[model samples]
Target: MSNFEFQLAYTVKPHKPERDETDAALTRQHLREKLGLDTVEHIETTLLGSITLNNSTLADRKREAEKLVHDYIHDALKELRVLSTVKFYGCLMVDGLGPAIRFDILPK
Candidate 1:
């Protein structure tokens, strides 16, 4: 088994009655800067977690990350279900959850 660090991101749908346009705009700005995207229209929030799994391939890790993201979206934040676009990013064998790991993940 190996340690996998995962980050889950999702954008709330604009049509939701509870959605705040201002909050969404701020979220979009924050995520665009964080993810280094040129432009992003939807509000995005990122959640981080770690899991140990038997798989070694990146494909397996990707599947596990997506599954984890889906489970979290379904269970913890049920409101996001069918109303949000989700993504997962994963890296193997992170040294620590501190600066070392974060520096490695940051875009160069």
Candidate 2:
């Protein structure tokens, strides 16, 4: 008896052509189809060629990513449902091999 949406963002890394396409498809399927969203909203991703350069700008980049993630989810939830109110939270992981910066929204 609940409706929910999830936004998953992940750092982009160099990949072989096949692997890259496969990864993208998988991410879309899991986040959109699995969650049953009408559409998969834009995923905020930055193209920092070297992981080292991104490290220096990590804080700023992450902040921007967070803002986009929240806004996308907030708007989508509002348009999708008539809820009393919707709640949102940004999930971040500083640890290596962490998940892409994303928002988990619950609208009821």
Candidate 3:
């Protein structure tokens, strides 16, 4: 059988302050649309979301991005029926010049 399975959900965010439901809902929607799957897995948000600093350096940009990603995830957690334990692995920047901020999230 394929390794695909279910339990805790892992996802990423590509945008913030979505013009839709709370940021969290936006993240979940993005995942559902992309994966063509329907699920409501509750997970905690650990990336210091919405705490971005103003700067042009790579580090500053990464911090900004990660926070946004986690914020959306946080919102999604509220819509879930069964909540998973949340943990924060850390943050990383998107490859190349995009420097998209991504929060390292894990289901505990």
TM-score winner, 2 or 3: 3
Tens-digit lDDT string for candidate 1 (1-108): 777565544453333335544444543444445433233235345445566656667656555555544554344323423224322232322323322121111111
TM-score of 2: 0.35
List ranges where model 1 is wrong by over 4 Å: 18-44, 79-108
All candidates' TM-scores?
0.41, 0.35, 0.35
lDDT of each: 0.41, 0.41, 0.40
- 108 in model 3: Cα distance from truth in Å? 9.3
For residues 25-87, write the lDDT of model 2, one tens digit per residue: 443344354433344246443211111113235465555555655565455545544222323
**1-108: candidate 3 lDDT, tens digit per residue:** 111122223543322224323444544444455433344434432222123344577565555545645555455553542123333333433433253333455443
Worst 10 residues of 1 by lDDT: 99-108
Please report the TM-score between candidate 3 and the true structure.
0.35
Best by lDDT: 1
Question: Candidate 2's error at 108, in angstroms?
Answer: 11
Q: After superposition, how far is residue 47 of candidate 3 from its true place, in Å?
A: 18
Q: Once superposed on the true structure, which residue ranges of model 2 sit more than 4 Å away at CA?
A: 1-56, 83-108
lDDT of 1: 0.41
- Which residue pairs in candidate 2 have backbone atoms (N, alpha carbon, C) closer than 3 angstroms, thus clashing? 9-100, 10-100
